[model samples]
Target: MSQPKDVEADLVFWRRLESQRMEVDFTKMAPEKCMAAMIEPDDVRTVHIQDIRGKETQYNLKLNGFQYVWHDMPELDGVAEQSHVENVVVPKTEALRELSLIIWSRTGATRTVTFAHRVRCLSEDEAMLANNRAPAHSVHSDFTPAGALKNLESVVPDVAEREELLKRRILAINVWRPLKTVQRDPLAVCDWATLNWQEDRVTNRMVLPHGWHELGKYAFRESQGWYYLSEQQPQEALIFTQFDSESEQADEGGMTLPHTAFVVPGTETLPARESIEIKMFAFL
Candidate 1:
């Protein structure tokens, strides 16, 4: 009557520093807040993680805050599977958009919002920015409540449409995948329901070129449940929630997923992880 345990490894989380406000901008482009320090190796704990390969489809986006599936892109699979030196054909924006739409149906998103997006295929070997750096190790969610609202303002061009969409449920979710087979640095995501939102959620001011907005960081809690897929390939994806309109409501939908790229033990000799995540919104 016992279940099988999966991959377990040490992953890092933000330390709780109530004495002083801790803030950071990975790009270092934002104005400094007191204790504007970055997450270092010393600021982490080795909470051994067990792999969750069996929970691929079992994890529900409405309940667990994350779901894993084989979202294969056959159109671009050959481009990723092989090694190219002379010319690398990146998936076009339209392709990524079409991919997201396909994934939406697979994920069982009941939201009625019509997705309008411009996706990009970026690699560290080419353009490097705050977003395109080494896989970030800190556990965090991309946006705060206010930030999601700001994002709605920016994305929805028409005022009437924005207001109409605001009346319904809104969500900002990230669809992440490895362009190629991941050798190391697989991502670990926390179940949103298990988080102690009131007591442990750490809010940070993230400055960006557009403007500064609140970002959700976390202080560790044993009750928080984390899971990840092993050796993720080009055919799979890790879809999770970033922001929710009814964040304070219950039984509405998944809220936030605290995710980080954790190093897989004994995989350092393998190739570095190369991945892409596209952010999209939903209106219900």
Candidate 2:
């Protein structure tokens, strides 16, 4: 028998269309759950079904699925930071079509994040279309609760007393980064609030070294998030911001953000290195 030659296939055909891009970050989902088992329909995000893929596809996530969430630094923490590994759901869509997942983060002062997708083929049994390959990236977006405390204060009445109760009840908060990477950190930034705080318990601070480098004099302030590139090998790195929830009870003991934006080490005027990357997937 003659030996058959191995054929190579074009991987580019499997990409997703750029126009279909949607925000998938975990920070957009409200009443987020963590490390919990799936249960009621409310526990999931209902994704409407469509014939875009062909088959009468009904796409929904299993109960208690894992997800990555983002949010602003806690009211107690000053910098803009991100939270990860939050549980989320894809609401049931009236018409079902295959969905893509992605993770993204920006660095430097300004960033131009771009992604691409392409359709592969249609499935006969499934009666829907399928991508030869999944998109390079997808996000698990968040839905933060708006006016969680404001509404509570309205019911309670006493301004100061209501404020204290709301702050203590705030399990977490989420924030978004509107600008892309540039050559420096944003000097003035605004973070969205979940539970409003009247007191200065939630903070913001910035620090700089003096003289000929103060050895361990890290920035300690003015950082929204943190990043480390394997390409750069330096045992020492600066801590932009830190949140301590010792006084108030927080969700699983921390805060959340949309995504961690990175900044280069050393001088504060250099564009961040772009070696860091995120890969997405859907389990069988």
Candidate 3:
């Protein structure tokens, strides 16, 4: 017998370059939604974007200037969707003269998606004085491509430390589905597991299935957003949720038992390395 392939899609994070760094918040929007950030100076030029969901995984990052073009997919197959981009432009003559951005996407339907962002007078006189010198060309020349598919089971950060850090934080694993309904019932079950590392060996924080205990204040929503904040450096618990096919399993308002943390002793009890696969919708 054959099994269905696990659901997973590429979610891309796009950023448009401007004079200064700005924060883009999606907290107020639906959790599953994807967006972009474009900083501008005086307006006149709105950042350009063609798609928020990308057709390909390849990303283009231009040097000399900080401009990013991202491509990812939407979580749901068919539902009314909205993508927003925020801009924070600084006024300076020597900074940057111009900036442009573009985002686009492809759904199963024939409809096309595209948008743009731009900024004017980015390189003014006074701005030039505050501008920082560009980094050494040798550093920029390092040709390292971005966006490589990674194994879902691969350990993140320091697993040993993560186990101990998880004690103080809420740890949940999530998966995204195509949509939310009876048709995708199997995909809706989200299982979160908490773990203790200092007490055990090999690995610390392991995914718990059929077991949801020791979950902290962290909450995971299907259409909301996911976060992981830790007070410890090497070891810390996190909440990794996104608008992916596997993200649905962790959806809120469920009757399932609350998540709890567990610990295993020594390296003998640990599995060599098992890949825990979960489906995600778009890349967020």
Among the numbered candidates, top TM-score falls to 1
User: What residue pairs clash in candidate 1, if any at all?
Assistant: 6-51, 7-50, 7-51, 8-49, 8-50, 9-49
What are the lDDT scores of the predictions, listed in order? 0.62, 0.20, 0.19
CA RMSD, predictions in order: 6.0, 24.4, 25.2
lDDT of 3 by residue, 1-284 (tens): 12222322112111222311223334443323312221121112111112212221222111111112211223222222222111111111101111111221212211111111211111122221113111110100000011001122132346774444333312121211112111211111122322111111011111223221121111222231111111111111111222122222323321111111111123223322111112121221
Model 2 error, position 140 (Å): 29
Which candidate ranks first by lDDT, i.e. highest?
1
Worst 10 residues of 1 by lDDT: 115-124
Runs of candidate 2 with Cα error greater than 4 angstroms are 1-157, 160-167, 171-174, 181-284
1 versus 2: better lDDT goes to: 1
Model 3 TM: 0.16
Q: What's the true lDDT of residue 113 in model 2? A: 13
